[model samples]
Target: MFDKIFQLGLRDILDSMPSEYVSLKEAVEGKLEISLNNGLKHRFDAEEVRKLSSIVPLYLWSMVRIPFIMVKLSSPGEYSINGSEWDRRAISLILNDLGSVISVGQMELLLREFKSLIFITLGYDSISGIDNDKEGI
Candidate 1:
């Protein structure tokens, strides 16, 4: 239900954008469209949309994978992202991109999480003790 509304809103924005921008961005993004009686609508290549959406999380996870992989290759007690610049940037970019698809407030909160993840990824801190604010959520 929520995703439907979200997609509709995105389509609406895409519809209002100038054709020149649409042709450029949509071409790069591999977008398609359909026409209705009322107006033009953004149409996604169905399989590509599904696959791209699925890969988002994988991209997020990939941000943390390198250090662990390298640690395993070396003799180590356990593989973990104790302090890594890659993790920080990777998580930041992922959430920021996700934020682009949501409302501004939601974007702020997501960025906050991304920051916290960076702190954790680096050895500076971890969320071992604090309970999250469920009401805010």
Candidate 2:
């Protein structure tokens, strides 16, 4: 039906997204592989992993997931982390800000500063309208 076709189109938009994420601990310990939605294996950069490990505390190693999914919201130039508190906390530590919503400038900074440690994707908000209270992996 038309709905099925539409769904497939939407899914294709997220084809580059990771199907699963590896924890910081796993990455640091040398398991730096993540599977993409298209069934492709994406390897994390060892140097980036080492740099991230140095910034985040040992206690948070297991809690923080690498390639943090940064969701682009419905609003223009707006994005937010689609992750747990620990992920946001780690980002806050790096950015030195407590805000959940990231602006275009902040997104640019994140992409530049932690290129390999984050993933950018279009959120459901792009179609369903903005919902600030939503939380996920």
Candidate 3:
């Protein structure tokens, strides 16, 4: 009863959250439990949940070319002699050397999906009583 009303009010708040957030409006209002990765579950209006949350894609753009990274599109781009087949070999050699020195790594493997991260920020849920402020109060 009370939860339903609270969920209605939180519609705007939930939507304001960043992408990959799972809304609990469904469980509060409609008794639906939507499960996500990392043991993070959300039960909210399935319709609203889809609209409120998004999957934030992780991009691996790690590169060592600091100076060349910002180069614009084709205002006289530099190539190591396009006509020479050796150019490919040379480039591959450079990349291999860089790979040897550079470290490859991942972070927060448990939080695979972005939604799980958002849930972590929000914390987990428990049973609500007449007064949510005090436990068994």
Candidate 4:
């Protein structure tokens, strides 16, 4: 898994994204939009994303051991995200690029979404942690 993330590098995926500098007010209000050269569009919800930023880096590092432990401790879901040194560098670069446009306060959301995007793009099921079959009692 690590080798895979390394091979797919964030730079190669995000490439050159053309972004606009938005005010902190706009960011916190969830009014920021980023359009990549590949036609991918990201419209951020500040409250939601900001809530996720601070812990994302740590999550990324630990995700390799167990991805969704926080979601369900009993099951803890899958054990994947085996990253490499290059992947670390790629994450740094990606965060740096994100930081340039996103305000410090809003970075958590961005990082959280970014992590999900990467995981989903790499063929991981976005809903893997949800136990749809569980009975509601």
TM-score of each: 0.19, 0.84, 0.17, 0.26
Task: Give the Cα lDDT of each candidate.
Answer: 0.32, 0.83, 0.26, 0.36
Error of 4 at 50 (Å): 5.5
User: Model 4: per-residue lDDT, tens digit, 13-131?
Assistant: 53533333333334444545665556666565554444333434543432221111111111233122223433333334444542112233333543465532232222223224443
Put down candidate 1 lDDT per residue, 48-92, tens digits, no spaces: 333333434444433332111111112112122222444434434
Stronger candidate by TM-score (1 vs 3): 1
Cα error of candidate 4 at position 72, Å: 30
Extract clashing residue pairs from model 4.
Answer: 1-82, 2-82, 2-83, 49-109, 53-108
Of the pair 1 and 2, which is ahead by lDDT? 2
How many clashes in each candidate? Answer: 0, 0, 4, 5
For model 4 the local lDDT of residue 12 reads: 65
Candidate numbers sorted by TM-score from highest down: 2, 4, 1, 3
Off by over 4 Å in 3: 20-121, 126-137
User: Whole-model lDDT for model 3 versus the true structure?
Assistant: 0.26
- TM-score, cand. 2: 0.84
* TM-score attained by model 1: 0.19
Regions more than 4 Å wrong, model 4? 1-11, 14-18, 49-137
- Highest lDDT, which number? 2
User: Residues 1-137, candidate 3, lDDT per residue (tens digit)?
Assistant: 99898676555444433333222332224444543433445444344323222221112111111011010112122111121223222223333431111111111221232222222111112222122221111
lDDT of 4 at 44: 50
